[model samples]
Target chain A: MTATKPYHHGELRPALVAAANAIIRESGIEKLSMRRLADQVGVSRTAPYHHFKDKNALLCAIAEMGFEEQNQMTREILDDPEDNNNEAVFARWVRAYIRFAHENPETYDLMFGREIWKGGTPTPSLQAISKTSFRLWVDLVAKMQQRGVLPGSHSALRTAQASWAALHGMARLLIDGIYVQREDLEEIAETVVDLLTRTTPDSH
Target chain B: MTATKPYHHGELRPALVAAANAIIRESGIEKLSMRRLADQVGVSRTAPYHHFKDKNALLCAIAEMGFEEQNQMTREILDDPEDNNNEAVFARWVRAYIRFAHENPETYDLMFGREIWKGGTPTPSLQAISKTSFRLWVDLVAKMQQRGVLPGSHSALRTAQASWAALHGMARLLIDGIYVQREDLEEIAETVVDLLTRTTPDSH
Candidate 1:
């Protein structure tokens, strides 16, 4: 994009990100580096430096890409006309989140676990997309409650917040190998959706 | 001990582990290097090699310590005298688990979120502790069903898993900055406990 561009390295930024992800997969986020990534992507060191001022910039970009993917996943589930009920809709969203975490553990980790926003702000672009994903949940839960799918007196707002955690914990742990058995995930995921939606006496 | 002891560091092994954990805390585990860790700890380069075969070994030991700390948290919570009752006991465990996640994000991540049982056999040394935690909820639900407080059907098991997920999810997100207000956490924690336990639909 500038005078720093190499003759053969036109899309060096994307290439670096892809290479970093590959290295994360083989080893983990710990081993990824600008020089190493540049070498693997066959780009000059200065190419990555131009796109990402530092490694955090690269990580932030990866996180933004991940958020886009997450938004797509959420949209796919939430916008699906075939999800005839609240339970079905929520279940689909949870599945999408779990799949996203499983496939893109590094990106997911960067987004969720890191204090990348430590200076009182995360990368604005990524944060906005992440908020969109969360809003999808908040809105969905509210709709479910309005339909009387979620109990009313119990504070649906709290339920929505807790609901995010439940799915996040399950997916994070599952992907991290803390809970390796694919055997029980479906049952657990379905139970989560139902538990969030089911009516209880306190609501009445 | 006999062969590898540097004159300066008689216990280079434990010192290296401590240094590695410090590195993990200050920087993400991805940036850690044996040489860098040694430099930080004021040890010779070869000193780390004698203690840690590699960084992975050091990481696993740190993770193992986390697992052990997790045990202490759960055990203390469960053993609280006021937590003898089913409702109180489960709530205590939830609070402790959440606190552990909040107080030690990196440790919790390493213990539970890092690679899924490194080396593929799923050694899962931590499984017993987690299952014990799981059984605490399962048993409480079983007791509720026995007391006619909830359904006696297989739904109880699903409900238990869901309940665990909900509590776990709340804590995970709270630590991850998904829940910004810390004061809201105590109130929400109590709300989740009361709603799930006290408002059994079966009681109707």
Candidate 2:
């Protein structure tokens, strides 16, 4: 009770989210619960309930944070002036995306795992954020297509889907420990980039 | 106790695996347990203990079944005399693979999910089956490359890995219900086939 009183009301939501993130990172997402998270955050058991309707809602919030972080990282990479070539910029984004998934496996799973998306029950806000992130990829795909960096023979949407599927698949394999060899990530990423942009004018 | 005496010892392994598959299909994998499965099978709880070491071992057995089924499907597709053209056969195989994953979501999840592969603890038999399935794919990739159906510039192993990653990614997306346009699967498969074999002699 004494510990609960010190945290301002405004701090409670972020505090709970931070604690939940820590729990999921240190342990696995299956180990998280509203009651346990409340205890970890030094709040009343029901306090977290006020902020998140249930575990799914809390997971959506955490996934939302990941999308925001990923979107920002992508934007930073795109805006950087150092790598002016389209292939170089795109390759850097692919590597960064994989790196993010590897560094934050639990959070990455939350962002793309079956828990939220399987039933189409993700919180509306979370869905919107995910769509925004995907939209960014689609836009980039369109730009690359226009610049002759990607094959223009296919529609931008289909091209984006195929390319994103490759990246997503590789990331899942690595993050889930199916592929097991961390040293091969770079080589695999390069191979994928080569496969995607092989038909480009610059490549020839 | 009388129920336990009826089943011969030799019949138990396949019986237990079949029950586990039915349980996973009817409900989700999380609802499956040895005791409940034993009850469902009209056997003593200890009966399942003799067949499966634990849930992980049981899951591996179930997954091993999926791989065998998938491998048979791929073989039948390859051996069909009707589609001798390499590109047509390859496209048919890709579509069949995605269709299998979509139709058998629970079984597919077990086959590729983190439950078996995350800790590198897949049963030796399961690993052997998975390797055999992959070897089939790598062999197909090599054949396609030799026939000028896939890019010869990339080594067969790397090409196989990249191509499999794409198919695996698409399968995961569809199976998890993340990408839920059943109508678009054929088109997506066609697009993937085009992407993979765009440089082929017949494609040109």
Candidate 3:
């Protein structure tokens, strides 16, 4: 109580974005509301309105953050120099991607689920960021192919789409609580890596 | 309306199931309700109660029907004698699978989504049927491996899990209106076949 600072309007945007993520992660996405977020952030109801046009805008902001986080993770994997074996690095990346999805299931859903892309309109900036993130993955797939980490028989786009779909599928299955269990992730991930890299571990 | 026959109480269960499917197809899963279904079928609201204990039970029934339909499709693909080239048959199966998801997006979602399996408890019968359906797919994968349709190096379960996850991921990406487009399914499917079969078409 000694130093409670008043919220400046400039800080309002980030504060609102952070608070909105908290609300979504705590409860389901359906439970989030602009008014509730504003209230939680210790701001007037209209304050959030000044920053976000509607609840959709707030959601897009959250999805945007998700893309940024995912893109950063991709970059970090690409930049990692500890492993000269591209196969091992690719496997590590697969585990890391699935781990990210498991740790942040709600945000991962918001990023890839129908909530923003289908049920609601994504902000232009959100679309741009999402596409950029995809491009990064595709480029990584091309680099992997060049390094023989993935087969070069197919175009990078097709390979990326197909393999990424596998990863997305595994992540979704885990997130949706389908046949997959969290404990089986390591084995499943290794198998996926084997399938994508076209490695014959059994033969060796 | 002139030749409308009154539904006998004996036929209420199947009638309710049929009406539920129509409702879900016409609108969406959320629009379906026990009372609504009864009214649509010209029965008392309580009549649906006898057939389905609650909405979850009705939903499980719908999901159960989906599994049966999916199983039948898988069987037909497996039994198809028209194509002896296992690779061609596998590609055809992949294309057919994506088309099924595209055509029955809502049902597919219900069958696989968090709606029945995660958000609600699946009926015992639903669980059994779903597992059987998965077993059919796994068996097919093992057969393909034995025939050199897919790589034989991995276990059937792992190969099936990895490749099926790729298919499920692609179907879901399309279903959820993500980056994948319906028009590109054929090309993408061929690429998937090559990846899973480890066939380098570019080599020749």
Candidate 4:
């Protein structure tokens, strides 16, 4: 074990989450163990319990961090002050999604594949926070449709769903080792964005 | 245990798949044990080993069965003689996807999740068969553009990828119990179909 770090290290909650994420990144969630995590942090085996009730609780917190990171990235891209147009908004959102999925394959799987937040059953704080990220996508698409940049009366609803599908499919393919490995994800991103943008009302 | 049935049931593979799917529907893949599956078929525990080398092998076989079923379903929908127009072509494919996702969730997850494919490589049979499904989607989009029913250039590539994204996203949400539980899937499916039917040639 390492030297003791004092209690109350400015903000133990966030610190603990960062530590947990580092472990996940290195060892995968499957290999994560509570005792090992506590020892690594130079804390008593039970100290982690003060911050998280159990392993699931800690996992939820880690997932929340991942979701927030993903949402912030999505918003920054979609709500860029300069690229607020419909095509830009839609395409950028898709790009953000693929990038997030590829970069955070483990966390992405935990959030979506684990069903940690069942629809309409969003009780956990992390689960609720994750769902909020999806709202950014919904609102971006809605704004674009309102501007007459896209067609379909339910453009906001359907397009958001559609965008999700395209991004999810691409990510799945990428993670599944499809399309061969590529250094430039931007190529795929641009291809997806170009397609979604062309589907806009102006395309006709 | 039930008595033995005739070996020449003529649909041994399909029957086994159906039985395995029923097990997945009632429980999850995590609950699918080979001995239990063999018991379900009134065979010795060793019986399944002949068909599948192990649990992973059985899962691959089941996934293969699902891909074929999906391929047939997609073909039926895409080749609807009455709905051969561009809009119809897109709608039918999207609808087929929705139906497949909803009706056979276990298969859908196995096909898309990429985790259960065993050691990150799909069996050769699964790979060869499902790869055709990808071409079907891209080909339909290309044909729609060629017929001038859908507009813009590169509709084939764009719509193919975008449509995949949307459909895959929704299917994933449904399987993981996160996306469309509260909404009428049929209505949403219609909306998705409508969204894809529109000509966004520039999108591709």
Candidate 1 lDDT, A24-65, residue by residue in tens: 878777688787888888766666888877777778787788
lDDT of 1 at B187: 69
DockQ versus reference, model 1:
0.40
Candidates in order have lDDT scores of 0.67, 0.81, 0.81, 0.66
Question: Which candidate leads the pack in TM-score?
Answer: 2
Question: lDDT ranking from best to worst?
Answer: 3, 2, 1, 4
Give TM-score values for chain A, per-prediction: 0.82, 0.90, 0.89, 0.76
Residue pairs clashing in model 1 are A30-B30, A165-B169, A166-B169, A177-B116
Candidate 2 residue-wise lDDT, A96-181, digit = tens: 99999988998998898877787337999988888889878888888888777778878887887778888888898787655336
lDDT tens per residue, model 2, B51-150: 7787788899889999999999978876677766766777778888898988788888888876677633699999899888988888888888887777
User: For candidate 1, lDDT tens digit of each residue in B125-167?
Assistant: 4456555655665766666656654444447667676676676
Best by lDDT: 3
Model 1 chain B poorest ten-residue lDDT run = B115-124
Candidate 1 segments whose C-alpha is farther than 4 A from its true place: A1-9, A14-32, A76-87, A115-121, A154-156, A202-204, B1-42, B79-84, B115-161
TM-score ranking, best first: 2, 3, 4, 1
Candidate 3: lDDT over CA atoms?
0.81
Number of backbone clashes in candidate 2: 0
The residue-by-residue lDDT of candidate 4 on B1-204, one tens digit each, is: 646766644555565667888898777665678778778877667776666666666777778888888888777766777874445666666667877887877777777665564244577787787778777767776777676554444446555665566677667766665545536455666665555555554453
Q: RMSD of candidate 1 to the true fold?
A: 5.0
Clashing pairs in 3: none
